[model samples]
Target: MKSKKEKGIKYFLKKLGPGNHYPKAILYLMLVFSIPATVLNIGSDIAGMGAVSNLLIPAIPSFVFSIVFTTVLTITIIKFSYQQIAGILKWLCLSVLLYIIVPFFIKVNWMDVLKHTFIPTIKFDQDYIEILVALLGTTISPYLFFWQATMEAEDVKHKIKAVVVDKQMLRDVKTDVNTGMFASNLVMFFIILTTGIVLHGNIKDISTVDQAAKALEPVVGKLSYVCFAIGVLGTGFLAIPILAGSLSYIIAETFDWKQGLDKHFGEAKGFYITIVISLAIGLVINLTGINPMKTLVYTSILYGVTAPVMIAVILHVCNNKKVMKGHTNSLLSNILGFITLIVMTVSAVMLIYFSLHH
Candidate 1:
């Protein structure tokens, strides 16, 4: 299912009906929330590191402006290939290992961890549900779905020769995706464990950067702050580009405008402009004096609220014989997909109910 250019989820949604605009609009809404969320995340990381180091970071507006300017300059002017970007991300990903190491350094209740791992506790209160939804939203983000689909399409299109879709290729794709998901979740698990164990009683709310960095201090001492700061900065740098690129791909594909990272600014003006605009909007959001950490939480909650609909659409497309041909979802895939759909739907409903009633 390779084409000459990247055709994202929007393209697949188009195949369902030429005139269907709702799905496209829903996607646009998701990106609208995602861009500012990503910008806020990056800004928070920069601010966090500065505070941890006791370096006088520029004021929030100037700091945010500098980040936007640097990002725009790097993406637009330098023109780094996807391979180079991936290489940098590989190093950044190692920063997650810091989280993994933290649990080993601190005392942990292994029995409790194992028990909770198998049987998670349930809570219906608004605060608990909100955090639960945010966790779900961040972990299974909608943008990742777009990013993976577009990048895979781009990869096939850029190949010199037509790539064959064989069993080996399918297996490779499965392995790649599985490995990535496993690693990501593992890092997240350790991060939660470290924070919950070390900072649970001491810090009631992690509203500031210093509070966040303190989770690592029990193990790494002063270097713990530095380590935490570096990890945040690294992951922020890695994620911001992909987040912007994913939004750009969605817009370009929906409107049938020219799009590709490999293309020059002059060649794909609309695509590049979309990226620039999204980043600019994110910058504007940071200037409004909203708390970055709170913004991140809200962003994740927004992702959670919209996720079930997106998942339903994906399940529809995957099961449709016309779209997948012989590559339709297997029984296991369908079962898991439905379970996710039901869980997310229930969570979102309860969240709404609790927010209004509580």
Candidate 2:
């Protein structure tokens, strides 16, 4: 009988075999086209540490260290089994919870927070519209869609059984996804709320990750700066792998090369190489003198422009009878998904208009 590692290798090999070639090809094309955005996003996260370096470390060296640290940690994580990586990712998810607690420590107008959260406040000014585009892009990112699907497939493949999904399994998947999204958005909401209350008018501009962290000091003491920095670092550690690994997986699958986190370097040279190149590129982005915050926002703009197309493709593919095999999306899913597509489309259009006019 084959060992567990052998079975895992065989499973990924099967995924690379003839089937789902079209989707694989699309993912590969999208990955290549979005490399700049992905690398910039990663660089921005790495640069986030520089925001708090005055209290934590020296700015220049801290920024450089962040890049090296992220690259090394990402490579080490990639060398683990998917199961191990998943477990680590779960813990890293908790790091963002600091944002949730921040709002309570700051003075906030609950009424205004409620109004903004529930009611759509229309603002057509250049900066306001640009922020809207950036928010939407950062939230519904392309890398996330690919990572979840591929990771699910990896989990199933690890089971080494027929692709027969049960009702309970489907329900569990939906629940997990919904819960995760809710937590993520809730964190984002609170971060915005606290920042708006404490730092919005007080700080005219936030250019670096350290500058952003500094804003938390007057509102919630110096320790809040530490929490904010830790959150950024934790999320970056979790995110870089997904950014690079998603692209690597797509490339490996597209070319029918060996893939999966469980495989050895010799066994999956191409897969690992793609990941290394991606991280290397991201590290180089940090070395450049580009303002990390602006680069991050611009990366989000890139994602905003591309998101509508990806959403449309996902909607079509997920709803196809042949593809879904009688398990197509429900009415609720269609409604939510299409609404997302429309919002992203509108955001992208408005962003371009404002950029031209402003």
Candidate 3:
């Protein structure tokens, strides 16, 4: 059996053999949907910060300038090591706590929040279903699976010496993933809470940067607004490179091109160029007058639609003893994975059904 040292999503797929092309095709479909969606997501973040800039400082010109400036800034940052990027992201992620604080400043009915959160309300309307799918896509994106697998491989690759993969390592992986998910969902919850409480009736939709920043105004006056704006800028700065890098990795792995953040630009020109080209395309997208907020929604929906197939492939690989080398998924893991797959699959189906009927 092959050692699992260099394991990745592609590696597992390859285990299916050279003739079975379904997994590879699914990856290709992911790339098709992901590249444009990621670019729009990056654009939305930039536009978000631009909205903040306009609100706080009138002299900063338009969001277009913001897009150009951010693109240049991100290109410089992507050259850093994965560790360096993670260090930066650690701080940027703290900005999400700002949302958690916002709800405290306003009058919030905790009981209602909890009720809606736990019990929830389901809607079958086209618009509601569409947004639901988008939410699923954003939260459980397909590219993230590839990114996680590649990053794990990179982690193993970067070790100075060979390390044993034991039960301890598996525990660490689970802990890391669980913690990150908790943090992600925590941020999402607070964001929705703040938005629903403050902007629900006042702003029907957040189609612009100004509307986005306004969600923080009630926290502690302009100070909160400024901090929130800076946080959005920080997050955008953090997310773009990761998004670009994920796209590059997907393409590089598919083609067997040289890749890795640790490699010098000259050593991995194709890999580096893929990142640049994707970012450049994203920059061009911002200039096309597409609604950044709308672009984000559409991007999420695309991810949602593509995620079910990817999840199915992942579940297959996780249970295959030949691929895992006897380290198959625990029952709990399989249960949760199936639950996610079912939810995403059903949401995608409902989105399609509503789109056709309505």
Best by TM-score: 2
List clashing residue pairs in candidate 3: none
Give one digit per residue, the lDDT tens place, for model 3 in 1-358. 4355455433443454321434567667767867766767766656665666666778876565666656675667556777777677778787778777778877778888888998978877999989899989989887788778777666655642444455766677778888999988998988778778877767777776666666556656767658767767777776777788888888997787888887778878888888888767776666666676677788899889988987888888788766676778899999999999999999999999988888
Each model's C-alpha lDDT? 0.70, 0.76, 0.75
Q: After superposition, how far is residue 3 of candidate 1 from its true place, in Å?
A: 13
lDDT tens digits by residue: candidate 1, 192-219? 8887787777777887656677655767
Model 1 is weakest, by summed lDDT over 10 consecutive residues, at: 49-58
Model 2 C-alpha lDDT per residue in residues 1-358, reported as the tens digit of each score: 7777656556554644324535566765676656667778877766665444534765457655766676676668567877888898889888888778888875678887788788878888888878888889889888787787778667656654444556776677788789989988888887778778767678989887767777788877868677877877787778888888887887786677888887788889999888888777777777675677788888887887887877887888788776677778999999999999998998889888888988
The candidate with the higher lDDT, 2 or 3, is: 2
Q: Estimate each model's TM-score.
A: 0.85, 0.90, 0.88
TM-score of 1: 0.85
